[model samples]
Target: MAAAAHDPAGAYDLLVIGGGINGTGIARDAAGRGLRVLLCERGDLAEFTSSSSTKLIHGGLRYLEYYEFRLVREALAERERLLRLAPHIIWPLRFVLPHDEGLRPAWMLRVGLFLYDHLARLRTLPGSRMVRLRTSPVGAPLQARLTRGFLYSDCWVEDSRLVVLNAMDAQARGAEIRTRTGVEAARRQGEGWIATLRDGASGRSETVRATAVVNAAGPWVSETLGGTLGIDSRAAVRLIKGSHIVVPRLYEGEQAYILQQPDTRIIFAIPYERDFTLIGTTDVPYEAEPGPVAISPEETRYLCDCINRSFARRIGPEDVVWSYSGVRPLYDDAAANASAVTRDYVLDVAEADGTRPALSVFGGKITTYRRLAEHAIEKLKPYFPGLAPAWTGDAPLPGGAMPGADFDAFLAALRREAPFLPDETARRLARAYGTNAREILRGARSLADLGEAFDGGLTGAEVDYLVRHEWARTPDDILWRRSKLGLRTGPDSAARLAAHLTRGRAEAA
Candidate 1:
């Protein structure tokens, strides 16, 4: 897929310049509305900020402290909507917030939880309630000093899968999704916008015309506008780095712990990947060029200290098996610190005398991506008069549709149909693909029918499906993003698999 300079026949109604959650979400919405859409990403979808979330679909309980009632309310409302839309990847989770003496007062927290519970209608999740940590099994892992805790309801998400499902749905609805392609520049051309898109592999540039452009480039939102589009907007983005670490499972059970730090910040210790504890999220200001960032020594220490203090079993940097960091391009509202920056999104539509529209999105969390998409489409509605009404709220994302959106029942049915499949394999496939898993294993009689078996239950059929449909090219795309099978892969197996996939792709070409 080499880029061509002149392709008059390839004109589009909208050119979305990012494949992260917001960009993919917008493309999905626009395409569902019958817009001719093209989305280009310099890397794989959700390769950066979109994938590097706390992986929660929740009303930010901490935002209440900042008086972001509108954001919290909107997110709370969207929580159930997303759960309905993508039940396969989004599930309700209970967070235990222990009331420590030196941190936020117990009554203040009670009031905040009260407000959080009443902010919106929660149909699938439970309301917050105080728990006697002294007697409850949920508190057995925590330090004895944390005798009092409050259990609140939120949702956990497969963050990267959310992005992929959106892009996949967009493509199914007739949107052109180009991964490993970058938009080099865009300019207002007469009544619309013309952009130069470059193929990341071949380094060839192509010219494309679109009715409008959406700059949802995540950490590169500002750079895409000023550096690439040569348009200065009234809005700007502040870079903030958020980091997380995955360690050997520290505690038992499915519940997660939200520990308040000494600096008035909070960190989450969640059960991850069946056998790991995921801890994270430091709000350190970043002042460098944006790319894949790593957890710093100081951040590692900070997170470890937070965990060590809260849990009975102490952990140090030595316990960390994997750590990742991503830079958040927050809307610069002049907050005093990185942690205080608003997670609400701002859509700035820069136009040439109100003719050619270029909308740049800044500062949004994953929890509110669908709403942000509706607003983004609304911002560009002036150019496309025949644009359809918003319908994503009621739409099911790819592989999310099942009777009543009940995952447990669906899993049981899958097990019945594929009785030869191991319990873990069946559960993983059902969780990952929902009804679509059937397409991969359709008529398969046994594990051998799935072709070569890889580490962590990954199969040749699954890899081929990802490469063919999900735009997965490299091993990281399959192992890390499309699935977390990498955690179980040995270096030799991974290198061998990478070479095999590369050769397979080349041979297919």
Candidate 2:
């Protein structure tokens, strides 16, 4: 571990390592609370586990079976809060759960959905309703044999953009945000922490001093603490890998499907990007390094089989258009099965000799990141007596503060302004960039003025905006993280983007 360098002035109030949802959430909250904060990520914002989520701001209805009522209720409440805060990015999504006799009984699911609806007094989203699948459009994609089902509500989010919006909000609130910067080491000084950060692209190092350090590295939490800070953290992080497959839209309606497998785990088939269906999530113990998590053949087969079993149309491995994997840094609870492990997060604050302190976050889900940030900062309130009070419950993230936070109205306004742009492009920009869509279209009057088209609905203007504002560095960062253009563009488009990025890099140099 590196020793603390001598500094005459006091160090920063907090230094957060990692640009994932949790890290950015913490940075935003801390900065909002009048604390001097600095956040650093070794790669692009949400370039790893954060962007690879199922993209639902859900309460995890299945967790009720494991008696995680508190976790479920908290997340359920947050779903509504996020909808109010970022209506452009997070909106209500109804889910259809088709009853299968072989998997779970209908009565049990009814009770689960009942508890889910009432657990948190939902305001904007409607309550759960029993459905006759034979008469409903949600049943069209399923086998004719399925006659009964239930409909419930959750929220969908642009997962990667959520992280970027959080980081942008933090930066707007006086927090120093650094992407492609790795925390080399951190050590306890007399009353603060001295840390070394290295630029990943250029290999340049800069020393920083901070009053406290938060290890919110998501999957890299344990490794960061033990390796970078030399702190023997008591909390253990269980690495469970989850994978998702995207295919052309198989269903017609806006509703998603929650299919119950024989193993008792539920697989989600969500309508994604207008023309694609997103199916996901196999829980397997993972020991691989934290970046570029790849979907294994076993996972691909498992998801395909699960989807095929529920729907009339059979899907196979070859039908998969795109796939992604992410390791959930779950808090270790000694669960025998990886699927049974808890998704709840735990915060451990270590203070040696009643002076220097280091806070380590164990596990968290995308749905509960905002609440987790508030709780994490609450844990450190005593250390910083002058820190402001908690206040992230109702705050708007960047690009989310449009009139009434109403997405439909915002879209109507944008369409009137940019009538020449395709309706699809206008809606996409409004949803992804919110009020900033004007900035992206700055001087463009026609499609030609927007510059080259790299992929479906992707253009040079959007790419430049991402590179300049969203911390997008490489082509993959833009295609995969900033947007899902990779799915629409295919392998060749990546090469074209690479060439464009290379030229931009050379011109800048």
Candidate 3:
């Protein structure tokens, strides 16, 4: 088993940089394949681009315009696989695309939806069907001008929790996961690669050696490769910033809306946190540091305008309760428009003289991250000739072993066991922790045993579970990654949590 403390001089079969979905997925896959793996992250898992996605596990419907047939098909297939494998956290969702003659012609939209439905052999989700806007509940929130729309199936995911779950599974499978540990430098050493990492909190530096290295740092991929390892590859990553705004729920149902903007770009207004609407996404080219990616005033206004144009209710800045931004590290395909950049990922393996190999991932989406990991490990198969064959397709992620993978039934069971807990709390715990919800609420007969209530449904026991098992080091991990309590919890709650964390760390030291 890999040690908890970083041993700079220790050797590893693989050292994966980045703790996002792609990186954590690769580490989990590689470790399961019998490779000694060590994954290092400069920040918390999914703190960057991975957590900021539109939080859909859908096959990119717009990719059809770019003629990315294969990519779309593979992503569509993965959607079903993920829904089955992690039903507790990922489930089916319906999207209503209101007709807009100015953006996309009705015939063209029909063709796209048709192709989307038929692209993958969908067995579980319902196919696309035209709805009468005047009659359907999905159309109630829309303007009266829109008479008809199409409702299609997709899957919604708890994006950040997905990353943490991957890391947890990887750790359970014997892979070491380190958060807030930055790889400061790396270089070729003998027939292997040696790297130095520093803990962000303590500034403690350690050296380690690895037979192979994977650069899956998302937006920092290029910088980590060239600056840390001194290897320059021809493949480049294009950074496109996308933003999302959360406002009070505008509709009562679970159905989401995919609105068509006049500029030919599509924006999604989805149900979030049960009481909020998540409207997002602009595709502007970005060139800033990956951290501190915040939604801009212009982007907020743009999203609000799109929503107001489609729905009868008009929302403004004051209505935006929360906002976030993330950069998509797309493969630089030399496309003139950022929206046209390819969502497909590219793997670059630098093995000069066939001695030391350093693999770097270019671009990938959350929906296709599992496939990306499988492909990445396949690339390293030549080095580890005895590695296990791909198996994640049939494997269930941690906490996803509900019978038939039926989330509703699992929630019913949880509510029966914890009758004293609020219905919402029981459902949230079951969804977030699956069968492990019992472990979190162990020995607790009532809500008071769960300890201090922070925000949303988060409790002290849940926070402690995240810190002990999920590699969560800071309060933000609990607020943002494990749960979106940051939006519901006031700033004062955050400060109190921070103080508690500081005290806990001091006592542990």
Candidate 4:
């Protein structure tokens, strides 16, 4: 287990303002570069926008139409790197895009796929090819009209877990990670920043000093700059709300469908949680506070309709098992359409004459977070002249150092080591914790030894491990972010887990 000491006594080299994907990624990268880093998040790691992604790491095929060649090439290259870096959470996935002659012609899509395949030259993923929907399993659930389609490759990621693992690696590298600690304000103190951090639970505040500050607040980017730091930022971020609805399994195959809508936009219907189909992502303009965002009725209906258009098995709003919405903080490119907005990120560094530097991140995608972090640190190299060179591209994340980087082989080894765990339970634990699963199953020899069971497969041992190592306090943190067992666990599961954690804390005290 990784233990972190909370002592913000001396001046630090860097203070990261957000705890989302970009913030955590930068924190991890900066710490690996030998910087004295302190990171503070108002909520749990990946509590908001970072946790609400479509959960795929791929080069944006659609962005090619907008002439975003640079973004597409970099994202495609990063996709391969991330696949190697975290094989446990990120794995290859085949995407089937059914032919839509009216929307985009067959030859046009072929050309796009050709560009996509060749853009990232050094790749092991199979190139795209034409497929007959009638004969292939991918076309089994699709409408009969969709006869010919194309198949390409991308990768699926455990999005929230990726964020937590980055934060974990950052903490393990000597970076201070404080969850539920919000930075209320910041001001120039001498040649550094004096930031006021407040603990939400205890209503306690502390003042810490850092030579530089990083503003990576996703949706709250502008707010953090103007409201918290009283800094004028030239760049602006557009908040576009993208919502997804999860319904009962629509098809039997493991492949995902990328359906093109009539509006020139696309929606994805991917396999989710083994029991459901994850369909999503409508780009609707949003203007509201970023916190507590939910899926609107119209957006939910839009998603259902989009899936209905592609799948032979029709579904209505009533078929939805779960729904979630998140606002994408895309850099405002003055585009009239929300879907056309650039997914690329912009780093704005402010360094007035003789003043401390503050870098604000504008927009980025989950697929390019590592690259984004590397870029952020590279931009600040002048301030920290002795900072180490970049090393995250080749380093394996926590628990990702499996033998041969093969998850299946590692999982088999895990089952062999712990023969008492059920097949399904062992698989789930291995996928979630990777090699660290042994740490949770250390002394347990039988099912009963795992401790109290919460309605579903959740056990007391797993909960304690989450609290002690992953900083998971509430039931939501365990059920939603750390794992998605909330869908299977009973209604009383949260209360039970809450009681257990409360009692455990009291006992520890």
Count residue pairs with overlapping backbones in model 4: 0
Residue 294 shift from truth in candidate 4, angstroms:
0.6
lDDT of 4 at 90: 92
Question: Could you give candidate 2's per-residue lDDT for residues 85-200 as a string of tens digits?
Answer: 89889998999999997778899999999899889966568889999988888888899878999999999999999999999888778788888899999998767898988988
Which stretch of 10 consecutive residues in model 4 shows the poorest summed lDDT?
1-10
Give a tens-digit lDDT track for model 3, residues 412-464: 88888889899888988988888888889999989899987777877778877
* Residue 305 shift from truth in candidate 3, angstroms: 0.9
Question: Clash totals for all models, in order?
Answer: 0, 0, 2, 0
Write one digit per residue (lDDT tens) for candidate 1, span 1-509: 22222235778989999999999999999999999899999999999999899999999999999999999999999998999888889899999999999789999999999999999866668899999998999999999998998999999999999999999888888888999999998898888888998999899998889988999999999889998888987798999999999999998899999999989999999999899999989999999999989999999999999998889999999999998889999999999978999999999988888788889999999999999999999988878898899999998988889899999999999999999899999988988887889988987999999987788888888888888778888999998899888889998778877877887779888
Runs in model 1 lying further than 4 Å from the true structure: 1-8
Off by over 4 Å in 2: 1-10, 490-493
> What's the TM-score of every candidate structure?
0.98, 0.96, 0.97, 0.98
Model 3 CA deviation exceeding 4 Å by range: 1-9
Per-residue CA lDDT of model 4 for 390-426, tens digit only, reads 9999999898998778999999899899898888888
Q: How big is the positional error of residue 482 in model 1, measured in Å on the Cα after superposition?
A: 0.6
Question: How many steric overlaps does candidate 1 have?
Answer: 0
lDDT values for all models: 0.91, 0.88, 0.89, 0.91
